[model samples]
Target: MHDVVIVGAGPAGLTAAMYCARGGKKTLVLGNTYSSQQSMGGLYENYPGFPDGIQGIELSERMLAQAQKFGAENQTEQVEKIVPLSNFFRLKTENWQYEARTVILAMGAGHRPLGVPGEKELTARGVSYCVHCDGALFRNKAVVVAGYGNGAARAVLYLANIAGKVHLLCTREKLVAESVYLERIKNLSNYTATFGAEITEIQGDDFVTAVGYKVGNTPRTVKADGVFVEMGMKPNADLAIALGLEMTPGGYVKVNRLNQETSMPGVYAAGDLTGGRLQVATAVGSGASAGISALQYLG
Candidate 1:
């Protein structure tokens, strides 16, 4: 049995592993970078310590390498279920099972995909979910934003300055957003918005070349270099829910802010799963606290 088992491999989970392993605990991290929200991103200028900025994948690699250097074992497996027992927790995967004295939940949120043809195949090629991470790639080029609401409006405004032209496609008759966002979108010079615009397909061989959509029963296509799906994020909370843990009103795992402890005795949560400012820096901080708390609990 391991002393601590972290159920993620993102920045938060990797940081926790570093702490727990360095504290002389037998640590095992169960997750990988495949579904990481931050990986596959371009440049992150906001994270500190790297004034010149860093690639998301590189940053994740560095975090994982550091944790492994401290004797943390990483197994890339999908955890099927987590069972809390008398004094330990059992983690079941498709091929293996492990028990741990303490657990840290850091399963982060995921981007909502457009669910259209070529959407999945063209990810990182020309289709992206985060404008901030991939907008610079489309500089001076044309792109389409397939979404509505405040997130989509803000994306239109942000892309207006980067891309040569930005088009907003909404499936409704009118854009649904707060007045402030609507006002901001109206001021963009190189932006066009069409309501009742439904994206039928995202087409490209290697990179996105155009967007297929329909507006008011009229089929149309727009030549573009990138497609940004501004749909909101969905938190990975299935395990938390199944474990009967207390959750916040937003459906995120509730945790003690000071120690990152969950409602259960030896269970803790951190990162986007706890739902605060979902950023790498904040996640690292939360992970540090959770690791320390877990170590103290084992003492």
Candidate 2:
């Protein structure tokens, strides 16, 4: 049995593996190609210490190399289920089963689709979810913030300070997020709020030039450099639920704050699956905590 098995290859999982290996534990990281960090395009500027910033793929590669240098093994496989045994946890992959003394879940969150025509085709060209990662691309330009939750409100507040104008759109009649966030966003003069609207189409050839939405009986369109979809994300918590770990009402795994310890004694969680601001830096930090906790559990 391995000392630890990390269930992702994102920043969080890689950081956990590095810490575990450095702590003298044998570590195995299992992940599928589809879940790799390369899918997130553009340069990450807020990752600290990078003045000019680094590409997401480059940052991920650096982390992966660092983990490998510490002797952590990686496997490209989708874990099917996890079964806890007498003395170890059994990780059942699609092709086989392996055992480990401890496990860390850092699979992160899944993006929500806008479900509008031309959205998939114009993803990088004009659609994005991360404001810190892509907000600079639209500096002094008009952008659309779609949603009314905390993420949407936060994005609108941030964009209002940078972008020339911000259009905050929501399908719901009233904001469903925290009252404080709504109050902050409403005070911005550059931000305009639209309610009970649903985007019908994202139009542009090879890029997004404008967005079409309907409010009540009227259709409206806005010219924008890009559209930020702040509709929130779905956490990858199936394995945690399968292993009988407790989850919050939002479907994220419940964990102790500092150590990132889950309900299960030998299992832990970090990153977006545990819920918070979904940032790479926070992911790595939480992963470090989970790794240290797992090491202590093993000891």
Candidate 3:
């Protein structure tokens, strides 16, 4: 049995592992290869100390290396279930099982995709969920931003600066966003936004060439190089739910704001799984807290 087991390889899990290992606790981090949502991002400008900005995948790798340097073992096996014992916890993954004195569930959320034909086949080949991440790829190219939520509106504005022409396929009759989003699109010269867009299919051979959408029953197709579907997020809380941990009404793992402790003793949760600001910085901060708390628990 190890001292601590962190069930993610994202920013939060890596930070927690680094702290726990450095504090003399044997720590193991179990996760998939592309575990962090940040890995799906591109040039992250908001993260501090990197004025030039850094790629999300690179940052995740750096965090992982740092955690390993501090003696945190990294495993790519995804956890399938967890069994809480009297004194420790047993984690079962695809290939192995581990027992740890303390457990930290850092499994972050995943992006909700737009269910449309060719979307699954065209992802990364011109179809993207994050405009902030993949927007740079469509620089100076015509692209379509779909949806009417705050995320979609923000994408329309952000891509207007990057893409040559941004056509918005608003899925609702009216934009369900703050006034700022609605007002900003009106000033864009290279942008056209319309409401009640029904995306029929994403047409492409090898790469995305156009988007098929409709304004009510009238069908239309817009030639574009990329499509950015800006829907909201869905938390990865299956393990938390199965563990019987207390959760927020929104289905996120509930944790103490002060120390990141969950409803159960010796168990902690951090990052998007706990449902906060959902920024990389906040995840790191909460992860540090979870690590320190795990150390304190062992004492």
Candidate number of the best TM-score: 3
Report, for every candidate in turn, its global Cα lDDT versus the true structure.
0.89, 0.85, 0.89
Residues 38-77 of candidate 3: C-alpha lDDT, one tens digit per residue: 7866557679999988988899989998998989999999
- Per-residue error for 217 in candidate 2, Å, reads 4.3
Q: In model 3, where do residues sit more than 4 Å from their true spots?
A: 115-142, 148-165, 171-191, 195-226
TM-score per candidate, chains pooled? 0.74, 0.71, 0.79
Compared with the true structure, what per-residue lDDT tens digits does model 1 show for residues 12-69?
A: 8989999999999999999986457667554576799999989888999999999999
Sort by TM-score, best first: what order? 3, 1, 2
Runs of candidate 2 exceeding 4 Å displacement:
32-34, 37-41, 114-196, 200-212, 220-230
Between prediction 1 and prediction 2, which has the larger TM-score? 1
For every candidate, C-alpha RMSD to the true structure in Å: 5.3, 5.9, 3.9
Model 1 stretches astray by more than 4 angstroms: 113-142, 147-166, 169-226
